[model samples]
Target: MSQSVLPQSIKELQHLLWTAADSDYPVYVYREGPQDGVIIDLSKLNEIIEIDPANLVATVEPGVKLGALAKKLAEQGLRFIPADTLFYQDKTVGELFYEGCSTISSLKYGCTKHFLMGSEVVLPSGEILKTGGKTVKNVTGYDFTRFFNAPYTDFGITAKYLLKLLPVPETRKSVSVSFKGIAELLAFIKDLKASHIVPAYLLWVDLGEQSVFRTDSSGQLVMMEFDGLSEEVSEQWKNTEIFIKKYKGAIYEVSDGCSEMASKWSCLYRTTDKYVLTEEIKMPFTAQGEFYKIFYEKAKASRVKASLFGQLAEGKLNIVFAENYPQDTFIENIIEAVEQAGGVSSGKYGRLTGKRPAGILAELEHRAKIALDPKMILNR
Candidate 1:
């Protein structure tokens, strides 16, 4: 494996990139490594540059941790919404946007790209480039801000960012419900949709035979989170309770609170380091039930222990398999099923930043890479 470079300042980073551009070595940027060749470690750059409460925007260094920033914002009665579906406390703001992470709140707040107002990046040629502006209504030439979101460091390293913020909700409540079967879970969700109940996020998860928590019942769990004024959250909770009861599902307040909910959701969503075979499937909302139906049957037939979970409103599915599972054919079956359902698969979960399939999207990325990193010294 190649060594790494830890730059403390933007000038140092640019110099490193410039030298790399002059060389034949490939460059890669990551917070942690196994990143081969020239690895750029950005840990020292963690800083919250500015927080403008009046404008509801914050400018932060790429290395700023998501949890830390959220806490800082919380002190001001604000929140930094991330697009990541799971709450990874250690994830940096740069990593979140670079990887195009999604959060359960995506149903209401949109993805990581949506909150990104602008960014400062060091091009592979060691030149500094800024895209977009602090204002939300910026109408730039090409809107390269969106293009750079989750570019996999193939174009450049995001050095700084301007992120939008939201006022913190007065109250937050989470409900965890258990269902005996997929049919029951589906019924509950159908009712939930029909009732026009919009929670911050609604997640349905089924960690098969090898699940770690609450496994005694061997049933699926659905978790819903509501945030707003106290009265509003209370009303939503009341409606949710009645709707869940009609399907005979048991509901309970998430005892520990939002932090606990985030931890549990992250645990369920992320594959253990031991299990490297993980996949993500995203489909249209209309096709979720059918996809799940087919997925469960195939998973059963294959006897692969699959931990399945998704954002109900957003129509995204995540599955993590055991380390030694037969992955090739299994993934093929999954892709085929997803395609049949008029859905798309991101292939690997968090790692694959490019959501579009490899043809046109690949071509576009190639062109963008050339435009931004002409030296081809960046991640390839």
Candidate 2:
């Protein structure tokens, strides 16, 4: 079992890093997985350092939970765009930023990286590195902020963050319509893309027996969320209804608050005994239909129960598989199908089949790691 440490202050964290480096002890920032060495938990560092309503910026500690921050910001008529999804509210600010978490709102505000303006990170060498600042446009030097955006390699541990904020929308609404098949759904999506009305997110959910969002009937649900001034949202909904009627879609639900729909949508991320495996697939809009057809056909042929949900505009899909399924061969087959359909799969299975970046980019990453953690004690 790995030992866990919670540093109370930046100085203590630096000291711990220095000691670990000197002793060649592996140190890891706590994430969801098994660890072989020391685990650094940042929960004690939680704090909402500052909220500048005038500038619409928030300075926060790594351990601050996003849900708490949202409530606090809402008090000031402000919100963090990428965290609009109610589910993300449960995650800490640091976890969301470091993991590059995105939500249905990503269609409008982009991802977590777009909202991050600056950060203070503690290097594995115990050196404190500051990048960006309170201002939105602070381009200078090497743009080290980008380097620390996701930090999949655990290059450094973030201590503080400067995040961008936006005013809370006056009204939020959602519309769900069910389509009998993928072709009809795709046609509706194509029209929505060309229309002047833009949604906060357009989700395509495929309901199956194992899906938490499954209904008495199995089919596809296209959900669109609109948020803005009340008049604007009302207008968008009007235009959306026209498209739904044109596509011969059966209106499943129309919600004014959007809370109920968002809650149900969050079930896509939930895991259960029956639904044990999940994978994210990214492809072009043109290839999305083919990819889905091929993937679902394979699953059906193999007797594997699977369901899918994803952002339609983003061309990203999440597939959930039944427990104790033939994941190895199934995943390999899916990856092959994704490539054939002109797309890519990501997750543990995809990583094994994906090729790493080569040449100068690879060398630069290597040098950066070596320079920041010469002893290689961080996240060892």
Candidate 3:
């Protein structure tokens, strides 16, 4: 920890963080390979400790990487099952949580919001606010952890976080099956749920050409991964194979290699490789599938083609468009359709990308910034 760069006051901290046009912000630029800036890096801390060890709740400095946290827990035969970052070995906890970033596995294990238990954030006033408890049942007051996903950087600055861990599944497995269209995909998903497959991550990847559905590589190549006891993995894998066979799908790879590849599915969401890409938006999960099938179909037919991925169980979706025409209309129609399906759509995505055109939610977010961070010194 370099005291020279660390700000002890709120106003000073904000300035130190994002300085003028030269400073790097996650939204404007998430990563720059070997170089990056504007982060809460606590490199001095050798290791972070859990708030309540018996309860499996942890309080970690912002510098901890998700993979490192996973490793720490795995030593104790447990896990912090968040979406693994692309740069798992490099991305910091502060970068992951504060940058409002999610990984390839978000569809199953969930985003930061799901596993977070509490936090110790430095507010715009420079006061250290301690919030949330070690247990899931400790819902005494408003939860600050959940707020991490709802971007309003001007209102909050989280440095230390408390997270909940899960017992590592003794048997882990993945299965993939694909259909000709979205309709078939939905049907297959429904059947999987009916059969109680209980996948850690359920995903749909439209490669604009060939698409496979399986946790591992089968001949037809729909990708899937399963985790649990050995008996459980064997049973689930066997059953999944039978189910895919019915779909006339072929299985390819199996075992460890299959599990490793299943982790790559989320790579489709990466924008860095494409360069000059538009902002990625997120919406409610149920708002996209059968819940709003008509709307999704209409979207596909429209000029603006958006790719959709979801954490249906978590009620969230990550949407991105390959062709960026009719951007406003596309987003507007999607939000309207989502509202029709009974869900709230925030302009949180707008803030994460560091761009907004002064809409209703955008206005509301600005007001929040003014109210919570009147000084306008927080990272907005």
Candidate 4:
């Protein structure tokens, strides 16, 4: 059995780390599963330390939930760039940052790494290290803040973060359309990319005979959102509608609820079932169509149900599988298909399957781990 400790302050956390370091048992931050070793829960540390509106920066404790922080910031007519993605609003700032979560708006603002300006990380040996600053251009030495970008809890635990913020747009609107097939959708996406109208988010979802966004059509859906001045948003939407008509896409009559339902489109299939597997693949735009073709063929051949949703411009695709499907064989085949399509798996499946690259980079990472976590007590 493992013991869980919720440290309410930095002093108490440091003491816990120091005590854990002296023992032979492993110590790690508590995520969502059963684990061996002492677990530290940092949720009590949640707090919005400072919001510098003039500098467009927000200093916050690691445990602060993103959705709550966004609402607080909105009161001042400011917002965090990454919070544009509604699905991740419930996640804590530290949790999402550690997972390197990206938003549908990545087409416009970028990922969690881009929003992280600075952080205060606590190492396993009870040492507190500060990296970066409140300014956007704070790089005096090695970029230590990015070292924790991935879910690399083995490195250290982040205590506080200095995140970048943006001014709330005067207007925001979304438009939804459906395509007969992936080919037409890809063509339309290419055309939209070349156009001057850039959207906050342009998502492609394939629900396969199930309509979730109130669309009567069963084909693939493309939902786009534009945010800016009222006139700018309206003009961009008008041009987008014209593109949909040119592509022969059926434009669905969707409400202007940009924040509510638009965020759920990608995550609608997620469930608490132990057997359900969701994998995220990163690949070139040119390879995405082929990847999906291969994925669907494999899924159909195995008689397994699978659906996909992703950010079109970012070349990121998430595939969700029905519960109780054969996990090993299907995932192995899917990974092989992803490699064949010139894509890399960016989810847990990749790490579990040993798909991560090995070389000098791997050696450097191992050396860093040994140097910083000599006892291997952090996330052991």
Cα lDDT of model 4 overall? 0.75
Which is the leading candidate under lDDT?
Answer: 2
User: By how many angstroms RMSD does model 4 differ from the true structure?
Assistant: 2.9
| Best-fitting candidate, scored by TM-score | 4
How much lDDT does each candidate structure score?
0.73, 0.76, 0.54, 0.75
Q: Arrange candidates, best TM-score first.
A: 4, 1, 2, 3
User: How close to the true structure is residue 49 of candidate 1, measured as C-alpha lDDT?
Assistant: 94
Superposition error at 81 for model 4 (Å): 1.3
TM-score of decoy 2: 0.89
Alpha-carbon shift of residue 243 in model 1 (angstroms) = 0.5
lDDT tens readout by residue for model 4, 1-380: 77788899887887788787878557767343236787788899998999999889999987898889989999999999777556666678877776556666888777768788888888777789988888756845777788754564367788889988999999888777888888888888887788977898887778556322344457878788889899988888887778788879987745564544465454442344633435777878998788777877887787777767788667888766656544667877987788877887765665434355467966787788889888877765
Q: Is candidate 1 or candidate 4 better by TM-score?
A: 4
Please, what is the TM-score per model? Answer: 0.90, 0.89, 0.70, 0.90
Which of 1 and 2 is ahead in TM-score? 1
Rank the models by lDDT, top first.
2, 4, 1, 3
lDDT score for candidate 3 against the true structure: 0.54
TM-score of 4: 0.90
Best of the two (1, 2) by lDDT: 2
What is the Å distance of residue 293 in model 1 from its true position?
3.2
Task: Compose the digit string of candidate 3's lDDT tens values, residues 65-150.
Answer: 66677777777877676623223445566666655554445545656567777776655555566677677666456665565335
